[model samples]
Target chain A: EAGVAQSPRYKIIEKRQSVAFWCNPISGHATLYWYQQILGQGPKLLIQFQNNGVVDDSQLPKDRFSAERLKGVDSTLKIQPAKLEDSAVYLCASSSTGGGGETQYFGPGTRLLVL
Target chain B: AQSVSQHNHHVILSEAASLELGCNYSYGGTVNLFWYVQYPGQHLQLLLKYFSGDPLVKGIKGFEAEFIKSKFSFNLRKPSVQWSDTAEYFCAVNAFRGNTPLVFGKGTRLSVIA
Candidate 1:
């Protein structure tokens, strides 16, 4: 089975500019996640979706970040008025289900550099 | 808030050397643990996971982790290292309570010399 797929492996933008990243998860997967990975740090969950419904997004910077899953298939993460601190890798991952003990597979991630 | 701690920031070892990386979490309640590895130019993938049952769990690439409930630790290990084992390893934890996102620690970068 194909793994998770992400677009624009790298991106650059100025502070206050807007940026968006796309993700297409493995077929039949029910859980999709967006994470931010700062240099030297592990990926941190920004949002999670289960079949088009948000499962968790407590850590998401609501004032600047937003994400959506379309028809429970594809997902997009957007950051408006991006800040320099937002310069980091954005990774997408998916699992067969949101149930217990399910393993998640990840994508190559989009590395964003905000000036 | 739940948090994870990876004691080692970087580790260097020669091939055939024993390996051990420490991981600890803050939450005391029921929790799930995982170890993920990211090779250069690759995505983060599961190395192993601990849900319940046996505290010792074996994962891909000859990696294993032992969960110590009393210590709130889940440490990764390998009997022997290889050049192929060079990667960034991350330890993550998720609480069993309400919808909680998995929290990860600053990763440990492992470099293995052949």
Candidate 2:
């Protein structure tokens, strides 16, 4: 089985510009997630979706960031008016279930560089 | 809020040397622990995980981690390090609350020189 897939492995945008990242999770996976990983730091959860319903997005920046997992198979994370601080790798991961011990699979990630 | 912490930012050792990377988490309730490794130019992959039962959990590539509930720690170790073991290691925690996302630590970069 193929792993999670993401588009545009790298991206560059100017401050205040808008950027979006796409993710296609593994087949039959029921949960999808978007995470922001700053350089030298761990991946931070931005949003999580179980199927088409959002499970958690408390840490998401409502003012500038948004994500959607329509149809429950693919997801897109968008950042408007991107700031220099938003220049980080945007990762997409998927899991089979929301169980405590379930392992998550990650994509290659889109590395964004905001100038 | 739950958070994970990795004590070492970077580690270096010669091939065949022993390796140990410390990971600590702050959570009062029952939780699951995992160790992930990201090789150069590769995506993150699970090395091992601990949910219950044995404190010592073995994973792929001869990697193992010991989960200490009282200490709130899950430390990764390898008896003998290989050059291929050079990668970034991340520790994550997931609480029993089914829908919660896994909280990850900053990560540790390990370099094994031949």
Candidate 3:
């Protein structure tokens, strides 16, 4: 089976510029997630979508970051006026039911470098 | 809120050496624990998970982790490591009841030299 897929494995943008990352989850998966991994740290969940509806986004910085899963299959994460701190890898993951103990499969991730 | 802690930032060892990586989590209620590994140039993958029953859990690639409820710890271990075992390992946790997002700790990097 194919795993989660993400676009633009690497990206570079200037500070204050806008950038967007795309994710296509595994077929038939019911839950999708976006995470940010800064250097030397584990991936932190930015948002979660269960069939196009948001399940959690409490940690997301609404002032600068936004994400949507249209039609519940593909999702997009956007960052406006990107800050130097935004330089990190953005990962996408998917699971069947997202229930407790369910394993999540991750994508290759998009590495963003904000200058 | 829940949080996870990995005791080691980096570890190096020769091939065939024993391995152990420590992890601790803070959550009063029942929770699920997971260990994920990311090889070089690869995406993150599950090394193993612990939910209930049998504190000892075996996972892919001869990896295993023991869940200690009282201590609130889940440490990954391997009897003998190989060069391919070199990777970044992350520990994560979430509530056992709800559909909660995972809380991960700062990862531990392992280097196995041949």
Best by DockQ: 3
lDDT of 2 by residue, B4-44 (tens): 99999999999999999999999879999999999999999
How would the candidate models be sorted by DockQ, starting from the highest?
Answer: 3, 2, 1
lDDT of 1 at B27: 85
**For candidate 1, lDDT tens digit of each residue in A1-115?**
8889999899999999999999999999989999999998888999999999999998899999999997999999999989999999999988887765667789999999999
Off by over 4 Å in 1: B97-99
Q: What DockQ does candidate 2 have relative to the true complex?
A: 0.84
Off by over 4 Å in 3: none
Candidate 2: where is the Cα deviation over 4 Å? none
List the candidates' TM-scores in order: 0.96, 0.98, 0.99
Docking class of 1: medium
Q: Which pairs of residues collide in candidate 3?
A: none
Candidate No. with top lDDT: 3
Query: Over the stretch B1-114, how does candidate 3's per-residue lDDT look in tens digits?
Result: 899999999999999999999999999899999999999999999999998999999999999999998899999999999999999999999999877888999999999999
Where does the lowest 10-residue lDDT sum fall in candidate 3 chain A?
Answer: A96-105
> Candidate 2: which pairs clash?
none
Measured against the native two-chain assembly using Cα atoms, what DockQ does each of the candidate structures obtain, in the order listed? 0.63, 0.84, 0.88
DockQ, candidate 3, comes to 0.88
